[model samples]
Structures are given as C-alpha cells and as structure tokens.
Target: MNSIDKELLIKMYMNMVKIRRFEEKANELFLNGEIPGFVHLYIGEEAIATGVMFNLNTDDYITSTHRGHGHTISKGAELKPMMAEIMGKKTGYCHGKGGSMHIADFKVGMLGANGVVGGGFAIATGAALAAKLRGSKQVAVCFFGDGASNRGTFHESLNMASAWRLPVIFVCENNQYASTTPYRTTTSVENIADRAIGYSIPGVVANGNDVFDVYEVAKAAVERAREGGGPTLIEAKTYRIKGHFVGDPEMYRTKEEVNEHFENDDPIKNFKSQVLRRGELTDEEMDDIDKRVADEIKEAVEYGRKSPYPEPEEIYDDLYV
Candidate 1:
C-alpha cells in the first residue's frame, strides 16, 4: 500500500465513491421510468474497477461488461456522456443509440460495454494484437464476470493471448453470481484464476473488496503486460450487492444472505476503513469526497435530462464506416 502514492490513493477512493453514487442514481432513474432499458448496477463492485483501472493509461484499451459504469468512470469517461447515453439522449457517446450496455468512448480507449456475455474477450484480445503489431506499448484489459468465464470465447482468447504473449489482462470480477446462479453451482473450480493455469499464464486472485489489494495485483499484471510478459488472469473475489438487474425478483438468494453482504462485505465500506486506518484520509476528507461525488451525479443527471434526443433519421448516421 505504501508503494502507491497518496494522491492516487485518494483518487481511487474518490473514483469508487463516484461509481457507487452513479449506480445508485441510475437505479433511482430506472425505477422512476427515466431510463428506458434494463440497468445492471455495479453498486458493490466499485473497488475492482477503481483499483484496476487506476493502473491504466488513457491510451490503453479496456473492454467492459454489461455492468460497466464503474469501468467507464474509472477509465476517465465523462459522467455527463455516460448518463446521457443511459438516458438515450443525442449528447451520448453513441448519439443515443448505444444505451445502458453499449456506451463507448474510443478516445479514452473504452471499446464499449457489451450486452452479450463474454463479448469483450475477443475485442480485448484483438486490441492487444493490434497494439503489439503497431509496436505500441499499450495494454488491453478485458473485464468480465464469473458467468463469462464459462463461455467459449474466454478459452479461445486466453489461448491465443498466451500463445502470442499478447499484452492483455483478463480481469474476472467474480461477484459470486452469474445472473441469479451462484458461482459455486456453475463453476467447477474453487477459483476462476485456477483456469488460467491451463493456458500457461500467470493467474492471481485478490480481495476485490480491498482497493489496495486489487491495485497491488493489477499493478503487477499491468506492468508485466507492458513489458511483453503476456496476459494475466486476475480473479477478483467480490460480491455483487445488487440484484442481476433492476426490478429483479431475486428469488435465487435468501434475504439473510443478501443482508449479510450488504452489512459486512461492502467494498466501499471496507475501502474507507482501510484508508482511514492507515491515516491516509481523514473522515472529513472522505465526507467531502462523498459530497462532491453526489453533487457530480446530480449535475450529470440534470445534464442527461436537458440533452436532446436524436432525430429519427439519425439512427442511420453511424451505421457505416
């Protein structure tokens, strides 16, 4: 933890807070009928995105999962554009076409959040290949969930990445559930990182709730990839505090089980505790960060609301190259 600078530590904390607040606000908007599509909230998994993405440069590429707001925010995407995209406004990243699961900012190297499970594996791999071909030191990161690890694309991507020594990092956000399915029931291995062994790549697991822990693991992996050391599969063992999607009946898990995670295993709470314990940030500073994040989200929502919708004919605009 001492290896990370104080400014970066605070930035990571602030980014986590931003992601939490943004997801909460998105949940509110969805329930209020302001947002049109289903939203997969990244409420409890903010630390994984914050920690991992903080290690990346703007030129580095990242492919996101369906629940990707945190990834986008952590990668330095603007909140107004993200909120606008969720609201299907013309000012969005995709001019209102790419909705909740598909917002992208190529300038910031966010390839796009995929609605399809395991969709980002190939994209990230291809980006890594391109970077290698271009003689660029850029690395590509693919963020996926436990469910995605079961997909065929995951194996294929890992094989190719390992064979070529591609500059890629495969981050498995093992939130313990694949939609409503518990990871234990569907996953054969005790940890998803174990699967990376088959491909002869380094596999590491980190306490996803602890930002420092995640940062430490990701920093090494990212550094390895940058140095042409090939891909690393990082299994971030965290919990998804929210339902699979907004308005989910959540009959798969018991109320008591959910309550326990919410009460004790919250990532943000754990992160704040770690920071405070280390005397890195005072309570007053944490409170200020929270306040600023709330204000930013408020402004983002307002900006989304005020933005115009695309014209009917505009749908065909970005269709061609």
Candidate 2:
C-alpha cells in the first residue's frame, strides 16, 4: 500500500464504485425492460478489472468476455456511451447493434466484448503478436471465466503465445460457476493458473476481491511482458453474486450461499472498509465519490434514454460481411 500512489488508489476505488453502481443500474433497467439483450452483470468482480487496468496505457489492448462492462469502464470508456450501448441506442459504441455483450471501443484498444465463451483468448493473443511484430511495447490482456479454461482456444492461444513469446496475459475470473454448472464439476485442474505450466509460462493466483493484491500481481505480469519475459496466466479467484444472466433462475445455488458472499466477499464493501481502516482514504472522501458516482449513473441513464435508436434503413450499415 505504501508503494502505491494515493491518487492511483483513489482512482481505483472510484472505478470500482463506478462499476458497482453501473451494474446495479443496468440490472434495474434490464428488469424494467429497458435493455434489449441478455445482460451478464459483473457485480462481484470489480476489483480485478480496476486493479489490472490501472497498470495499462491507453494503447494497451484487452479482449473482454460477456461480463465485460467493468473491464470497458476501467479501460477509460465513458459512462454515457457505455450506458447507451447497453440500452441499444444510436449513440452507443456499436450504434445500437451490439447490445449488452458486444460493445467495443477501438480508440481505447478494447477489442469487442465476445459473446462466445472463451472467445477472447485468440483475439488478445493475436493483438499481442501484432504489437510484437511491430516492435511495440504494448501488451494485451484476455479476460475470461473459469469455464473458458476448458476451451480449446484457451490451450491453443496459450501454446502459441508462449512459443512465440507474445506479450499477453491470460486472466481467468474464476467466479466459481460457468453459467449453471460449477467449474469444479467440469474442470479437471484444481487451479486454472496451473495450466500455464504446460505452456512454460508463469502461473499465479490472486485474491480477486482485493484490489491491492490484484494490482500487485498484474503490475509484475505487465512489467514482465513489457520487458520481453513472455506471457503470464493469472487466476483471479472471485465469486459471481448475481445469476449467469439478468433473469436466470439460478436453481443450482442456494440463496444462503449467495447472501453469505454478498455480505462477506463483496469487493466494493471490503475496499471501503480496508481503505478507511488504513487511513488511506477518509469516509468523507469516499462518501463524496459515492454521491458523484450515483449522479453519474443517473445522468448516463438519461443520456441513454434520450439517445436515438438506429433507423430501419441502416440494418447493414456497419456489417463487414
């Protein structure tokens, strides 16, 4: 904590709060039928995105999963456009075509969020290869879930990145479940990071709920990638407090378990307590941030509501094929 700057700490805290508030508002809007598509809420995994993105430059690339709003926001995306994207408006990143899951901002190096499970691995790996081929120091981070660890793309991309020494980081948000099934039931390995050994890359684990821990681990990995030390596999252990989608039945898990994690393992709540206890930030400052974030979210909602929808004549406007 002493090694980290005070401003960076506050910024990380602010981003985390923004992600939490944004997701909560999105959930409410989805329930109210304002959003058009499936919404995968990143309610419990704020710290991982905030911590990791803090170490990156604006040009650094990232490929996100279905649950990607937190990643997009942390990567310097504005709230108004992001909210508009979720609401399927013309002012969105995708002009209302890619609602909820497929938002992209090439200006910020966020390759489009993938709706396919494990879809980001190859995209991130390829982006890293592009940087390497161009003799640039840019690095790419791939954010996926525990379920994606079992996919063929996960193995193939890692093998290729390790063999060629691509500057990439594979971050597995091990949020316990892969949709309706627990990863424990489907995955053979005890830890997702352990698979990195097969590709001869460093495998590490971090407490995803702890912003400090995630920042430290990601900083080391990013530094290594920049210095030509090859790729890293990071498994950020976290839990998904919400259902797989906005309105999932969630019959597999108990309400008691969910309630326990929400009470004890919520990253935002834990972050506020830790910072205040260490005298790193005052309650007044945090409260100010909270009020500002609430106002920002409210404004974003209004912007999304006011933004126009795409016209019927433009169905193929941005299509490539």
Candidate 3:
C-alpha cells in the first residue's frame, strides 16, 4: 500500500540477505582457521546498510566501519571477491593486502572500511568536500556507530560539511553498544541526531531494525543532499546481535537484552512479514531467496578456502602509492 515497487523492495531484501549470509560464512571461516584475521560480523546491522545503499549509485561514495561486510556487499561487490580477500587472494579488491578491516573497492565507490573507530568520518567528509568543489552531484555517506558520535573528528566532519555545504549524510547506527560498552553511558545527548543542531543541519531518528523505515528516511536525506541542501544526520536505532568481535564474550550485557532485540525486532524477520502480508511477495519467492543466498555463501566459502594467501612481495604492494 506504500506505492513501493515490489521488485525494488525485493531487491533491497536480497541485498540484506547477501550481507547476512556473507558475514555468517566469514564467522565460520575465521573460527575454522580459514580467514586469518580479526573478523567483525555485521549480524544485526544489515538493515542500515541495505536501507542506505538502496538509494546510492556508482558516483556516490560511502565510508565504512570495522563491521563492514554488510556495507561492501550492499554496494554491489561480488561475494566471491570479498571472501577471497579475507582469505588473502590476489584477486581480492585490495589484492588481499588489506584484509578484513582495511578492505576497499573504490571502483564501486566503497572508500574502504577503517579499523580505527572514527577514521572514516574525516575521509568521507573530505570526499564530500571534493565532490562539492568539483561541482559533482554525488553524495558521500559516512557510516559510524553511536560511540563514534563522541569522537572529535565526527564533530569536525559535521561542522565542515555544513559550512561548506557538502553533499553528505552522516548515518549513525546506534546499536545500543560499542564493543561491549553500552552507548547510553557514553553520550550525553538524548538523541545522536540532536548533535546536528550544533552545525545547523537536518537530523532524523528512525527505527533501524525496520529496513523500510531506514530506506524511506535515507532516500529523503540522499535526495536533499543531492539538491545542494548540505548534509543530514540520521541516527538509526538498532543493535548488534553477535559479539563485538569473534573473541568477545559480550559480558557487559545480558542474555535478556540480546534476546529481546534479536527475537523481537529482527530486520530480516520483520521484512519477511511485511512483504508477505502486503502481498508483495509469495512464500515461494521468499523461500527461493533464502535458497539462493545460502548457495551463494556456500560458493564463497569454497572460494575463500581455496584462495591463496598474499605472496611475500604482495605485502609491500598495497602499502605505498
């Protein structure tokens, strides 16, 4: 009833599924000694990536966080290459030198995923500034967690984007925790979006667990920025279902908190219900999607498993110019 096209809606769902399956496979690979690095799973934040990326294009750019497989897949990078990269393959986007956290595929406008907590904000802001100066209409999106909101660089990026009228959107996935630390204990602001007032930009908060909610909000922000309206601050209320990293036990939180969010507001489940009840998709279609994603991930795992590690000379290749 929302006038949304069924195919495009399903496309968004597929992207989220791609990310979910990829991250799950990565987790397995890491534990079994295949993907040899610190792997952070983006289990609970798929909707945020799917929603924002649904409105992006090749000219547009995005900055990512440690938990970035979702962002990468949502931007259209093939699953095989990503898995291969984590496996240290020469065919990887980074030639396998920039494993997990440092992965990037700029050809598709994935600036890169930073290992540093707040590193991406400044880089994305600069990319936006470049776009503004060149008179390019492309928008730059910086995806950071709630904890990064308190970083000095985030504030600086916001002020600069506003002052220069850069086409940018700051998407804060306030997933309630940052590496086992509760977000509420860190930030004083009632809403992370409220910080936009300091820079005179528009701000909005949305239920991030709902893909459609984030999609609609992100579309508006992207459109506004494209029209030379400067930046927008969008805070999406979501959560990370898994541990902060593979080794993290997540002792700071309780089983109840995790169960409540994952079981009640799971993005994939909510999307399935809406698509079904809205008559946008058949049960068979949904099942097909599940089957396809499972197969795609299976192939990726095999590719990652067979992929070779970076050659000794390859290590120095990606370091310099």
Candidate 4:
C-alpha cells in the first residue's frame, strides 16, 4: 500500500480521537441527566466516519443515520453547537429543536441524521441526482448500517442511482448487530457489499476498525463518484461496543464479547501503535492532540450548559406545514 501523507494521517487520527472523546463525553452527560433525548454512542465505529469524511470535500454531501455525531464532527460541525444541540439549547445547530438523532450542518454538507432506519438512502440519492443534473462534480455519501440494507429504500435508491449513474457512494457500517439483533440472522448475505452486485455496481469490503483501510477504500470510491463512475457499495466490518442507546440494558450480547472487541480491536489504540511504530508521528504530537481535544470537549460542555433553551413560542418557527 502506498504511504499516506503524514499530515493527512495525523489529521485522520485527530478526527478519530475527537469522535471518540465526544461520544465518551456525551455518554457521561447523558448518564448524568444533562443531555436530553436518546443518545446512540458511536464509541467503537470512529474509524469509518473519520476515514470516509477525510476523503470528502466540504461541498460533498453525506446523509447519516441516528448514530451520527461522529459523521457531523468529522464533516466539520462545531463541537459547541453540536453539544448544545444534544443538550437541547437554543444556540444549537437546529436551535435545539432537532436533538441527538437529527443534528445537521448543511454548511458542511451533513444532510441531517435520520431517526428512521434506512431513511438516508433516498435523501442521499436525491442529492447525487441534483448534483448530476446541475452538471457538478460533487458526490453524496449515504452512511447506513447493516439493518438498513433490508429496507426497500436501500434497494430503490441503489437501483435508481445505478440506472442513472448518479454520483453517490453507499457506505454500510456493518457493525455486526443491527440494534440488538445480530445482522447474521437478519441479513440474507454474508457481506452487505455483496448486495451491490444486484445493482451492477462495485462492491468492496474494508476493515472499519482500521482508519487506514477505510480511508483507502473510501478514497477510491469518492474519486470514482466524483469522476462520474457511479455509486460504490462499501461494507465496513466493525463492532458496536456500546449498547443501542445510552440506557440500554444490553441483554442481547455478552459482556465478554463486547470487552474482547473493546480491548483488542480498538481503532484509536491500534492506529496510534501503527503510526508510532512507523515514526509517522511522534508520541509528543499525539499527547498534545489528546490534551487539546480534552480541553475542547471541556469547553463544549460548558458552552452547551450555559446556552439557554429555546422559547416555547419558537416551537413552530423552523417547522414547515
């Protein structure tokens, strides 16, 4: 494999760290009754978002799932507004109206996170269609999970995109289990990428836990889409270390299983080890980044706490009839 630029690798590592830290902080706040609504922590799936987003330009569009904070952050969403949004403050991106599952920053091309399973399929496909119609090189990425592949929207969007040769990339974050059910039981195919065969598109699978692996695959797909090569289906094989939600009892999976993944397959730890071994980045640089991220997260919590809640009269302000 070709060596990635040291600067880019460092940036990717930083983004992954940010995603993990933000999720950890959010989990803490949620447990402490500081954050409102349901929180789906993307603790174990940082590499996929960080790597994929790194390959995308600010003008490139992406539709996200409920577990979307990582996507938003990786796409350049400010931490303060994101934290405020999760806490339901008026200073948030949606003015606190759209909580954890619905955060969006159109300026960064994050086309909102969907609460419904597989909801992003049509939206992303539509964005790609719009780009194609406008005769632009922009591409749209749809980030869904293994569970969403079962939805009709997935098939419909893939078929239409393939037929029209839309500039879109279908990224399936196949974290093994969909909610509480094992994807093995629910999914008909062994790998979600295999589904792309039916749509007559390229199907590729990558190690979602490895940022470098994900970056390479996503880079190729993004490039292909920008060059009008049509959509590509990338299935990222990883695990969900956390429960479905913050307060979930998680009776479906065993603790030993979760612990094993957390300990051995930790993306951040593995990334650091690999880079450090290769002398790509110094330990001091990584330590400084860790310190900076900690400080930023601390400030974000403060910002969210200090921000006022939206007034009752403004409930219908951003709503469309």
lDDT of each: 0.93, 0.94, 0.88, 0.94
* Model 3 ranges with Cα > 4 A deviation: 1-3
Backbone clash count for every predicted candidate, in the order shown: 0, 0, 0, 0
- Quickly count the clashes in candidate 2: 0
TM-score of each: 0.99, 0.99, 0.97, 0.98
Tell me, what's the RMSD of every candidate? Answer: 0.8, 0.9, 1.2, 1.0
Which tens-of-lDDT digit does each residue in 1-321 have in candidate 3? 373698888798888888888888788878888777799888888899999988999879999998888888988888888988888787777888788998888889999999999999999999998888898899999999998998999989999999988899999999888777888887898699998899999999988989989999999999999999999999999988989898787889888988988898889988989888878888888788889989999988787777777678765674667
Tens-place lDDT per residue, model 1, 1-321, is 778887887798899899999999999999999999889999889889998998999999999999989999999999999999999999998899989999899999999999999999999999999999998999999999999999999999999999999999999999999999998998889899999999999999999988889999999999999999999999999998899999999999988998898888788889878878888888898899889988999999999999999999886897788
Indicate the residue-level lDDT of 10 in model 2: 82
Clashing pairs in 2: none
User: How would you encode candidate 4's per-residue C-alpha lDDT over 1-321 as one tens digit per residue?
Assistant: 365887898788889899999999999999999998899989999999988998889999999999999999999999999999999999999999899999999999999999999999999999999999999899999999999999999999999999999999999999888998999998899999999999999999999999999999999999999998999999999999999999999989899999999998899998999988988889999999999999999999999999999999998896786
Q: Which stretch of 10 consecutive residues in model 4 shows the poorest summed lDDT?
A: 1-10
| Candidate 1 structure lDDT | 0.93
Error of 4 at 288 (Å): 0.4
